[model samples]
Target chain A: MKYRGKVVVTLKSGVFDPQGVTIKNALHSLSFESVEEVKTGKFFEVLFDAENDAEAEKLLEAMCHQLLANPIIEDFDFSLEKVK
Target chain B: MKYRGKVVVTLKSGVFDPQGVTIKNALHSLSFESVEEVKTGKFFEVLFDAENDAEAEKLLEAMCHQLLANPIIEDFDFSLEKVK
Candidate 1:
């Protein structure tokens, strides 16, 4: 079976997020005064073969740990779905 | 009232995705043979004040168009939720 998966990798709380700060400043300069903060992260979608949804989930977790995210500085979460 | 929102900006289908290709190659080198393709995108989380969910959605759309995303090469989708 083929599975589609999405991984969202975000900076762990307390990590310095300069990119986010830059964007927030830009937003304010643009007059989005209501906006409080902006946090930026990485999103990845993958296509892979798996035995089932469970297998796909397992693979995605491995991918996150191994390559998709830097666990030392980031936290990751993901969702997997069977695809036609 | 405050709203929490998420924006996902992805390269449109058929657009060149070099980051994705480089990651896919890395995954293969790591021996994830079943993996077919990988796509990379940007994720953003925002906190902002709004009159209601409707207003939040409108603001998020504008943010994407004006600052958060480059519409010429990317497509964006977002969800907004009321935050207590």
Candidate 2:
């Protein structure tokens, strides 16, 4: 079976997010007075072949660990759906 | 009311995505022979106060248009869940 997945890779807590902070500042400048915070991350849409759900999950995990995310500064999570 | 929202910003189709291509090549290098494609985008987690769902959606839309994404090269979509 083929599977489609989305992976969200985010900075772990306490990591400095200059982009997020800049975005927050921009929101404030836009006069959104109640804006609290903004955190930014990466999102990926991947399509690949797998035999079953377990196979897909394992491949996704390896992909996340090896390439999609930087383990030192980022943490990753994902969801998969069978596509045909 | 306060609401939390997630925004996804993606490069429009046909826009050159060097980053995505580079990542795909890396996956191929890892022996993921069946890898088809990889598309990369941005994810944002935002917290802010709004009077209601309509208000929150409106604010989120404006944020995406004005700041979170570039209208020229990217398209953005979002979802909101009321938080407290």
Q: Can you give the DockQ of every candidate in the order shown? A: 0.92, 0.86
What value of lDDT does candidate 1 attain over all alpha carbons? 0.92
Q: Which candidate leads in TM-score?
A: 1
What candidate 1 gets wrong by more than 4 Å, as runs, is: none
Superposed on all Cα atoms, the candidates' RMSDs to the truth, in angstroms, are: 0.7, 1.1
Error of 2 at A84 (Å): 3.2
Reference-based lDDT, residue A75, model 2: 96
DockQ of 2: 0.86
In order, what lDDT does every prediction score? 0.92, 0.92
The number of the candidate with the highest DockQ is 1
Candidate 2, B1-84: lDDT as tens digits? 889999989999999988888888999999987788899999999999999899999999998998999999999989899886
Candidate 2 TM-score to native: 0.95
Q: Which TM-score does chain B of candidate 1 obtain?
A: 0.97
Q: State the lDDT of candidate 1 residue by residue for A1-84, as single tens digits.
A: 999998899999999999999998999898898999898999999999998777788888999999999989999988888888
Can you write out model 1's per-residue Cα lDDT over B1-84, one digit (the tens) per residue?
A: 999899999999999999999999999998888999999999999999988778888888998999999989999999888887
